[model samples]
Target: MKFQVIRLRTLLLSAALIAALFVFCLLGNRAILTVSGQLQQHGTPLILIDPGHGGEDGGTQSADGILEKDINLQLSKKIEALLHARGLQTQMTRGEDTLIYDAGCKRMREKKVSDIKNRMAMIEAAPDCIFLSIHQNYFSDTACCGTQVFYSPNNEKSALLADAIQKAVITAVQPENQRVIKPSGKEIYLLYHAQVPAVMVECGFLSNPEEAAKLTDEDYQNKIAAAIGDGVCNYLNNKQS
Candidate 1:
């Protein structure tokens, strides 16, 4: 009876040791995850998302009467949510269909220029931030379609970001899309003169009837937003490595 009690005590001790080891490992993993999250929050730059055109400027319109500005804002908001879920910071240029120009500007043209300048100033102030302008494309040739990303010429980092986003969109949303990343020219006011890394994502060609329909779909917009979030995370990871 004495020998049996000793064996039972030994077994109980062994089980206790195993349980203690498991707890230690669990705490160690939690500590690592916390540290990892901190690093991610520290290293990743805030994303400045600009939903192009608003108010008087309806931007391009599809044959079905869908407005580009509305679609841009919707997609931008979706992307912002995904970024937030991934623990990344984000800022939006405009949350509603209103002009951001100074109150002094009364004329429509004056308001447009002032709004653009204000956006530029915001970009300049946030030197470490990544700028993403969401817009839809319109072409006389309805044959042209697919999402295209344009990066600022002033920054090499913009090209890398554009490529990452473009690849993500193609891979996740449209596997058949063969669109390539292009550099912004003088035509793009914000991208042409940006001091920080910037990319304008042309979500889709509104000129194409089929693409326009797809762009209006909520599910499709969500997929695009999730892909963009993945691209941003991937870019940040690569930068850290």
Candidate 2:
């Protein structure tokens, strides 16, 4: 009778173990399915637009004393408006002319690191957002002028987005935009590290006298914005298809 009891206990223990395993598997599967469905729902994608330089940092300047930071902010606002018009949502890193990020107290490299970390944290909070940085380029060579789009090296999808934007600029705004879309190498810190699709657009070169004049023109700015809007529209359409 003692041997019989031991065998019966062993059978009961085995059944309990099997039951626990079945419950665990059921819960795990339900969790996985729920997560997968959430991902599909949130895949609409948000665009994080970062306008380069602000306040103390004036970025590149033009002959008329126009600051690159101001131009960048203006362009970014235009882009945001254009995107909204198409029912797309956007978030700007700096909505004003002054500082948005704290550069820290110390002047050491750690301060810079802290600044970057702060920026990264802001970015990380918006995981579904892709990135677009707006800036104007300056070259010692005055002959170099035209819009150039650069994609993040870390993301292959960024290359396609850059290409579409470049095409839009060439077809809609400047028929002679021979600059071409290229991959960013060592220029932007955010683009270098982003796993999301990201690109930096250099609207025009301030060094070129004529281009500088055009960059400051209100009508010309609208044209540039329209081109970018068209580019983004095309990209989204293609993605959906």
Candidate 3:
């Protein structure tokens, strides 16, 4: 009888420990979920993604005929997906390979101006938003390669955003990249006029054959998007902290 009582006490103690462990795990998971939800609800900033040129304006072209507009849209879509997965809010100036110009615009130049104006309007419409424009770079020399970032001069925070993206891309993929972020001049219409924090990512030089090949690759574009996404998230988190 004494042995049986001892065994029964041991069984009771084991069951109690298991019950306590289950409760602890349940509470821990709930705490994690709550923190995640809070960050999604309050910590994230609205990101306005503008994929550079489209339609008649194909921007730059690779030696193999890959269009910069197409690559920009593709990479922007990937970045949008990454941001959404992280529970962040995002809006795109153009989702398809079409210009966001006013219907009244007729000539090519007029349409181009209208498209840029409309994109700027979108950036201004959002409250406390971050503007990220994706584009491909080109130079007369094919030797010029690697990603570069440009920031709007209107806002001080734009430089910080640009630095984050430039560093993130180099650290994540192009370890050899030595290019630094530059301030946008009047030449870049959108960035020059943007009132909110804005940065344009010149993803790579389409003029360079080797870089062009990598830019056209779907896998490489995804990696670029992921790095940009990480940079945006890191910037926002740091700002919040």
lDDT of each: 0.87, 0.79, 0.89
Residue range 1-241, candidate 1, lDDT tens digits: 9999999999999999999999878755443222113322336677889999988888999988999999999999999999988777788889999778998898989999999998898787666788999999999999889889999999888998998899999999989899899999999999999977899999999999999999999999999889887887777788788
- Residue pairs in collision within model 1: none
Ranking by TM-score: 3, 1, 2
What TM-score against the true fold does each predicted structure earn? Answer: 0.82, 0.78, 0.82
User: Cα deviation in Å at residue 220, candidate 3?
Assistant: 0.8
Q: State the weakest 10-residue window (summed lDDT) of model 3.
A: 31-40
Stretches of candidate 1 above 4 Å error? 1-42
Candidate 3 TM-score over all chains jointly: 0.82
lDDT for each residue of candidate 3 in 1-241, tens digit (9 for 90 to 100): 9999999999999999999999878755443222112322334667889999999999999988899999999999999999989988887899999998998899999999999888888887664678999999999999999999999999998998999999899999999999999999999998999988899999999999999999988899989999999999888877888
Best by lDDT: 3
* Local accuracy of candidate 2 as per-residue lDDT tens digits, 1-241: 9999999999999999999999878755443222112321243466778888776678898877888989899988999999878776677888998645464545545444555555566566666566788899999998999999999897778988888899999998889778888887765787788777888899998888899889888899999988987887788788778
